[model samples]
Target: MPGRPHLIPGLSAVPPARRLGSSWSRGVVASAAACLVLAGCSSTITIDDHDLSDADRAACEALVADLPGTLAGKDRVGVEPADALGAAWGGRASYVLTCGVPEPEDYEPTAECSVIEGVGWYVPDDQLTDPAEDATPVALSRTPFVEVLVPAEHRTEGIDRALAELAPVLEEHLGEGLSCL
Candidate 1:
């Protein structure tokens, strides 16, 4: 299969933004924003969980076991129908993380990956178009690829915090790799 254009072909710098003026892109951003507002202050956050293979499910369970109680200064919130491998943090679930995601078919080993503290991430420029509003998928560059859905409102700083907080868990459970510097 053809790799997604947004994927880095090799260890390279960040890719330029692709859907700057696309209407659907805008909708994605808007949807994420809406989720932030609606979920803010809610004790439990709703998660559209992933259906993972048995092996991936087991791996996800291992990865989520060590998730911190709070992230980016927001306390962890409850997830409804919470059997899936996932977690939400912040008053409005500014950050939502799900494990056991499949590696992007366009996975590029040479992509200019980001390393938070030490964990490497495959941040696809065009995140998956999730039906659930406010869910942006960021893949952990490891076996069984974990995906974290971060609110658009919490892009840089919030994202950094989420990665930093989760790095240890990932490394401990899934092993670690150096950033594609």
Candidate 2:
């Protein structure tokens, strides 16, 4: 008995503490390494800077400053050219918001629009009706126009959630007047 290994009826000779310490610690380390790798893989998103007048630039800056840290369950990511008038979120399926953009060429006084949280957003007719489109470009229907490009992968739920999350912020900075009529 003194020289023989101690064993339980249905368990290994290794103690629970020792087994957990070795395998659990390895698992934790592996998880941490994977997180680091994924973080490193996220590259900065590039967004083109829009030409803005002095007033529009200041307002856009303020709006950018107040943007939420996360949008539609995605963490905010850096935008390239550092001082571009926009912010982005996510990696592969990202959403980009650009401020001070020109009005859409086809926008008419009677164009269809959706109002979210006191903000009016206009999506082109084709994109609005088509379910196969990969991306939807939504433009704010007010001054200091803002545009958000939402990937279709997010679907209607993601788009609606993102717009709802952004609506209050847009209203605060862009004013509450002239929402979708």
Candidate 3:
């Protein structure tokens, strides 16, 4: 999880203890936005100059492994690959959008680790507070999935630029009629 959109700096999923402290803040944010599940997944993206320590790296690896079950099936739209699926733990991405189909009625519930950038400070394009009006994102699987961004002095900075660069080339391959997530 290097280049694409990640929860780089400002992006952090709250721990259970922390959640109790920000109950009001979380409610306000939850009601305002919709969730975006990355439809198709490519390799792990690398964007910034992250110097995670060994312990931190281990933590991140564990987090990614825990993500697949969270995105079971929110096939917004797209196709799956011809090669057979990989082992659940063998995959780089937690979930993949292999089943190309119409969007699901309800997205798979956002999990603790699935809240945002599994990386560090990445924010979902769909969740931008006041994003560009003509935000034609590089569709992940018909809908915008994740973007690994370059890090800026601030966690939220550099994201827009990453989106600009990423949205153009990350076209997904639509197969069958369901989702791989």
Candidate 2 residue-wise lDDT, 43-114, digit = tens: 465566677789888988889899999998999888766887788787742567887877777777776566
> lDDT (CA) for every model shown?
0.56, 0.60, 0.25
lDDT of 1 by residue, 93-120 (tens): 6777766655556656666555545556
Better of 1 and 3 by TM-score: 1
Which model, 1 or 2, shows the larger lDDT? 2
Residue lDDT tens for model 3, 16-58: 3222111211111110112122445443321221344554344
Alpha-carbon shift of residue 141 in model 1 (angstroms): 2.3
Rank candidates by TM-score, best first: 2, 1, 3
Best by TM-score: 2
lDDT at position 157, candidate 1:
46
The window of 10 residues in a row where model 1 has the poorest summed lDDT is 18-27
Error of 1 at 21 (Å): 21
Query: What's the C-alpha lDDT at position 15 in model 1?
Result: 30
Candidate 2 residue 9 Cα shift, in angstroms, is 57
Model 2 off-target regions past 4 Å? Answer: 1-42, 176-179
Q: List the residue pairs that clash in candidate 1.
A: 10-110, 10-111, 11-110, 32-134, 40-92
